[model samples]
Target chain A: MAAIPEALAELVSDMESISDRNERAELLIETADRFGDFRVPASIASKPYPEDHRVKACESDAYVWAVDRPDGTLDFYFDVLNPQGLSAMAMSTILAETLNGQPLDSVAAVNSEIVFKLFGKDLSMGKGAGLMGIISVVQTEAKKRLAAR
Target chain B: MSVSITERGYVNPGVLVSTDWVAEHQQDANVRIIESNEDPLLYSAGHIAGAVQVDWTRDLNDQLRRDYLNKASFEALMSRIGVTHDTTIVLYGDKNNWWATYAFWVFQLFGHTNAKVMDGGRAKWEKEGRPLTREIPAYAPTAYTAPERDDASIRAFRDQVLKHVEAGGPLVDVRSPAEYTGEKLHMPEYPQEGAIRGGHIPGAKSVPWARAVNTEDGTFKPAEELKQIYEQEQGLDPNSELIAYCRIGERSSHTWFVLTYLLGFKNVKNYDGSWTEWGNLVGVPIEK
Candidate 1:
């Protein structure tokens, strides 16, 4: 199936000169008329900003953006704009463990979630669990498709 | 066969059509698609062609104070936007589904069910290589008669939130860890003291907004998966009252839509005050 229909493309490519809000609203209504029922994967929607990632740490600000593997395919991005005296090395170590499946020692795990009492430790663990669940499901589905093929 | 009353509510009274669906039905004459962007001046550079720009933070909000979702003000907003119950309105904005969900929840608060967040929003529409025009279309003013506000369907004041807390209802914090834990409040604004002095509200669980979605596309997770995420990982009971919140209720709005629209949670509310109002208060207790 086509990702974007043709009539809609004509409208998007020419969106540079519109000024009046009313006219724009009308055009969108018209465009929606041309191509509104299109369905695509939920994961295919966000605009990617993979290359522009950074990590910074200071007394107040700690923004960490690191690529787990140099391949740049599955890099993790975390931006902590302000740190209440969190250690940079400690933060990195936690992120590495959370993303790379490394073991977290007692002290590391304690400081990992920051507010250990609330929200629980292994904060990103939920995400990892979700990803693993999806991967397994996708693999099973893929095998089924392959067998059918 | 005629639809039953229970089935009637889920059929979204207004336009819940997709971007493509709207494109085909654009000739309906009563529909209006507004590009609810952050900045209209920047909007002029380009928008969904023929789409009008609405500055949500400024125009749609009650800027004098933090009271944006009051009934009187919300009614005026609907009337001024040329929206009526019959108007097939689709609201969207940049940054994926961020602002789109916010707009969707606002319309729902006013009891307008026809409104929908264009799936994938402007990002997907643009990515699909659909047409984005420069000419803006003018809309004739329409009279929108709002039904009695469905207060139960929406999250209201701190009193209601406190009630939920007392009842052991689920309060889902959709903000990032930084905001949830009082690590960083408003980004690039305020004193970064976060919306609250401590961490999250008592009895609230932290579930970042991004987790319910696939980061690549702005659409929600599959219904079954979403159900699992909330019921198991997040520990949200479907039968229990689920109220979601963020710094200013935007992120939580998305969660509200997911729980109510997709997951079919009967009692769900979006705490409009969110952290901004809840956390900023002097005496309101907070939990880390």
Candidate 2:
């Protein structure tokens, strides 16, 4: 597993500590709203199929891109193009917050099941948690960048 | 030759309306624009000026249960959201209106028929460069009463789906092809929402939810095309009792929308408790 970046460690704890199922859902919604506030243009956000970056596993046309920081860290930014997919957006925020400032080596090794470990099996996620599965994609992206370096 | 996307040959032309039509009626007291997206926060980013957000996982869902809100709760939601009996609800959202259609299906579950989908949903509107706002509406709540959800008409349970299969009824697997065939349903990290066994119901047909809608603008195809695919290609009779399903009920709701509303099928139901239930059942029949 990759090392948890200090910035996102707090968010991970915050999301994990939410006891109320409904409030947990709300937190995801809030995180998604924050993402929307960034207002990433459609040209950038809309990644159609076969772009390779698209999160096709889930129903939404979501995409994730990781940029290498000058300090050799990875910054994660994602867009779950579906407006209703707050849970997916929250999943991206989790990765962004957790890995954004982490070293490339650690980011590449980040575990995709971090949520399963964090939330445990309490998430009554239906049809698998498509958005949460995105950690693997982000980690892979980070690993590719690391290899390029 | 293709027909106009806006004008479809159907008995209920009211099922789908254009973004321009929605724009013209934004201020109509009788109409309410509800933005129901796959991503929860899209409404906050900048939704249609007068539109309100419907949280499928919150408002429409039973917070404590896997099912939807009970009738009383649904009625209360309708009231709180300022929806009345006659209010013309126009639903729109991202993912080519998947959740929008799911929301519409839920509304139908409660016998709310005044609702229609905004053609192309959030995608089409945004593509057309329509105005979007961050104004969270604070409309005056109104009197909205809904009957108990009529499950028998527009919804399907596991037992019914099983029997429907036994009778060789028309069933549409609206999931992606990989899912319909029961392959690649999960990952090493995430436990995918799939049945223990893969494949589909014995007599089911794979329609692939995306086929019903045009991918470019995220709008549904013309009525004739839809008819051709579901009827001519898939061999579904308009008079038969059709059922649509996916991993969850979400994607199938889009297909249900195509059959029930667009094509004017007399009896169509969305198996909201779709693949998850069918896949998990102990003794149900499956087809690879």
Candidate 3:
């Protein structure tokens, strides 16, 4: 059996044990990866899948890129799932900027470099986390640029 | 400690600064602009002068919750971004600023006082007619301040949720019809197993988080609109003790903001453990 990464192993374990009628069907995917073929109760199996932009961002590689609309003032998102990583990244970027007194743009670049290294692989492209990682770097850099002027 | 770039980046909410703000401050060289265009590689192809990409879920999510928001690993994350503490942050994103709001909440929890969410995010700024450039910007490094951990502001743990359940409190599941119905659950671990052997908490309700926002661009709906949605759709009362949860707590956080911030509900609490914890509990009773 392929071992789940330590970081993600606990997540895999927890997914297999969910007892929610509605959640079981969904956990089946995770279970199959870790546990094995199992019957999803007919009640949960029969339900329709949820339709959410974030879920789409997680499951597919269709990166709906967006540029600033019309005037091009700020950035635009292709879908509702664009800003998922914004706050988490911003918190640290802001702290780094304040603590080190380093220029925000520089920090943004550092972050970008890091994100690029982590998720830049072809297979990882366009996932929610991948896209968000990049956004954190860009947004941090953007803040640096804006603050200086 | 080594930290991933995503973990260390800033956690400010999305804000749409006008072109004038960008222009007037263009020469300042301190403000950084991030494109956050949903696609990092795409942003590399062409972005606002110096903008980079930011990951939404992975970077901003509460890793501890893995599915909720009770705790966050912010300090370890900051070191990776080279931010210590005391940084002023401006954040923005397109599509009504859902990502922006998420960031705003995170920063607030971490006690980053200087952070602000761009009003209207990218959509409003663009509509107002602002100039944009594809030139990448450069800059030096800066220091940042670490925030105080305040669990009260951001999350509620499993015990808290259990207490609420024990008290016969009502919980609001903020996922969509498919998610709530278990047809479209996000976490892959539970294969069709409802967290509880049955389904939802005995008296829980489904109030899709999207209902709190205007579908047009992802911005939250007006207070009146939210009130209407809660009353008509989920039977929520401002005076009741309410706990909101989603796959984890992002959507529920948005709902929390709306309920507490917009609707001015005093007794609302966010069930950070949400379905992820509740559904997985061993002996908890569930309803279908």
Cα lDDT tens digits for candidate 1, B149-240: 56566766788888778777779998778767877655222233245364788888898877766556554555556767787887888777
The TM-score that candidate 3 achieves is: 0.53
Q: Per-residue lDDT for B1-288 in model 3, tens only?
A: 212212322121122333445546545444544433343333333344544334454465554545423323565444333343454455566534545555656656777655544444565555556555545544443444454666675567788777878898878887677666666544222233234332466577888776765545444555556677786667878778788887555567667766765566666767756776677788876666
lDDT of 2: 0.76
lDDT of each: 0.54, 0.76, 0.48
Model 3 spans with C-alpha error above 4 angstroms: A1-149, B1-58, B61-88, B123-140, B186-198, B231-233, B239-241
Error of 2 at B165 (Å): 1.4
Higher lDDT: candidate 2 or 3? Answer: 2
lDDT of 2 by residue, B191-282 (tens): 44545777788788899888988877877888888899999998999899999888779888998888887898888888887877887789
Order the candidates by TM-score, highest first: 2, 1, 3
Please compute DockQ, using alpha carbons, for every candidate against the native two-chain complex: 0.02, 0.28, 0.02
State how far residue B204 of model 1 sits from its true place (Å).
1.3
Between candidates 1 and 3, the one scoring higher on lDDT is: 1
Which of the two, 1 or 2, has more lDDT? 2
Model 2, span A58-100: residue lDDT tens: 6555677766578877666677766546566667766765677
Residue B24 accuracy (lDDT) in model 2:
98
